[model samples]
Target: MASVTLTLLPGPDLLFVITQSVSQGKRDGIAVSLGLCSGLIVHTFAAAVGISALLYHSAVAFQLLKYAGAAYLLYLAWMSLKETGRSGLSATEPKRSFFSLYKRGILMNVLNPKVSIFFLAFLPQFISPAVGKIPLQMITLGGLFFVQALLIFSLVSVFSGMAGEKLLKKSMGSKSISYVKAAVYALLGVRLALLEK
Candidate 1:
């Protein structure tokens, strides 16, 4: 519950989902949410198996992942800005394919070393050695987090999509949406870049 609440907070993941929802519509937003959750599933498994610990302790690996995540975000920002005029942000549909949105969601989450480190630190606190198996317990708890995240993210998708539809229908600030999203992506990239191992 605590994890879910924290996830619900307006962090990068939530922000990204909202941006996707506002631009792409409900279906694409849901797909992107699924991709993000899938990345969390990977993190959960890695935490249980100790791969997350490796990322947590290894400064080199951590730095590499952080920069990679930042670079990816910057790339996204560039692409968004480059396609600004043609994106039809005011249209009812997204210019990009569903698969592309899904893949972007996965890449965005997977490349963030902070998430892996968070799993390593957060999951273990809930797990007990007295349990039959630490790995199993970690996985179970992580699964709970994934479910909560999915539900919350989906809700965000629906609401944001509706909001987007209204904005598009009004044809108000359509061009601004693209520019705002680009700024957001660029800012997130800078945030990731400033993170320490």
Candidate 2:
């Protein structure tokens, strides 16, 4: 449907990032993905306010951030590929703080080039400039999108919890799945970085 596509404007690949990461419940992985999704909320609001204007008018600024993000993503990907999807902490729980995880989610979305661009591009479709209060509309729409994202991403969290918990119980092999999850995040980051304008 149109609505589904719009919320997921970046397409199936992005979903794949979430899906693959959620395939198991690495708490850190789920935390990171939620952090990313939460970051989208901030991007949505910032775009709704003025980031979209800057992106539309300032070519240099956009490119600078784009490349920076790309480099980071590639670094993540390279790190992932280096181990061929094998990491020692795959089954170990790191000392992660909940507040830090939430903060990380916010940053992931904020630093994410694709999300910044998508909010700049997508939410305007249903807006009516002629009706009145454009800022209000952007806010309303952005809020709606956040709610949609929250609903979906939270479900992802639950699944991540369930799946990871279930798999972890079965065998030691579950640890390798953690590496694949990181690889997915890195790849998703790289792909997002490569997008044009």
Candidate 3:
């Protein structure tokens, strides 16, 4: 139940997947979600082994990662604006390969230190000394969480993709959607920038 709640909550990861679904299509959104969840696997492993603790405690590492995530968001915003110009009057937003979207999702999630911190802090709650091997328990729990996230994200992608398809059918609507996508990306970047390390 907690996993479902957390996955459904409004957060950067959810927002990004929604934007991708609305701007591109369902496939890209699912691909990106898979990539993002893959990053969570890394975080799970790191948390299990205590590497996430090292990141959590080190100021320099946290700040560097925070800035990098912010910069990437800004870059994505810029890319959206550029696509907006080129997509003028087009029926589709733009074309980007599935692999590219997947890679971007992985990089974006991996660079966000908050995720690592969340795993470090949250996963321990479900673990008990009675579980015997702690690392194995963490991995199992994290995988369960990821599965829930995948389902929620997939639902979001489907609905958003339907909306995007309908909106992009008209020339004016396509332009409007493009501008909205750019605005959302810019806002996400600003939000990331304002986060304190």
What residue pairs are clashing in model 2?
25-164, 35-105
Candidate 2 per-residue lDDT, tens place, 1-197, comes to 45455655655334543543444344544566566666766777777788766775777777776777656555654554454333333544344466665564555556555667777777787789898777678778777766666566666666656665566464554545556655666666666667676
Backbone clashes in candidate 3 total 0
Top candidate when judged by lDDT against the true structure = 1
lDDT of 3 at 60: 89
The clash tally of candidate 1 reads 0
Report how far residue 50 has shifted in candidate 1, in Å: 1.1
| Model 3 weakest lDDT span, ten residues long | 85-94
lDDT of 1 by residue, 33-142 (tens): 98898889889999899898899889999999999999999998887786566544535434668778788888999999999988888888887797779999988998
Candidate 2 residue spans exceeding 4 A from truth: 1-5, 8-34, 74-92
- Write candidate 3's Cα lDDT for 59-171 as tens digits: 88888988898899888888777776554334553566788888998988998888999999999999997968999999999999888888898889999888888877777
2 or 3, which is superior by lDDT? 3
Query: Model 3 Cα RMSD, Å?
Result: 1.9
**Model 1 global lDDT (CA atoms, 0 to 1):** 0.85
Write the candidate numbers in order of decreasing lDDT: 1, 3, 2
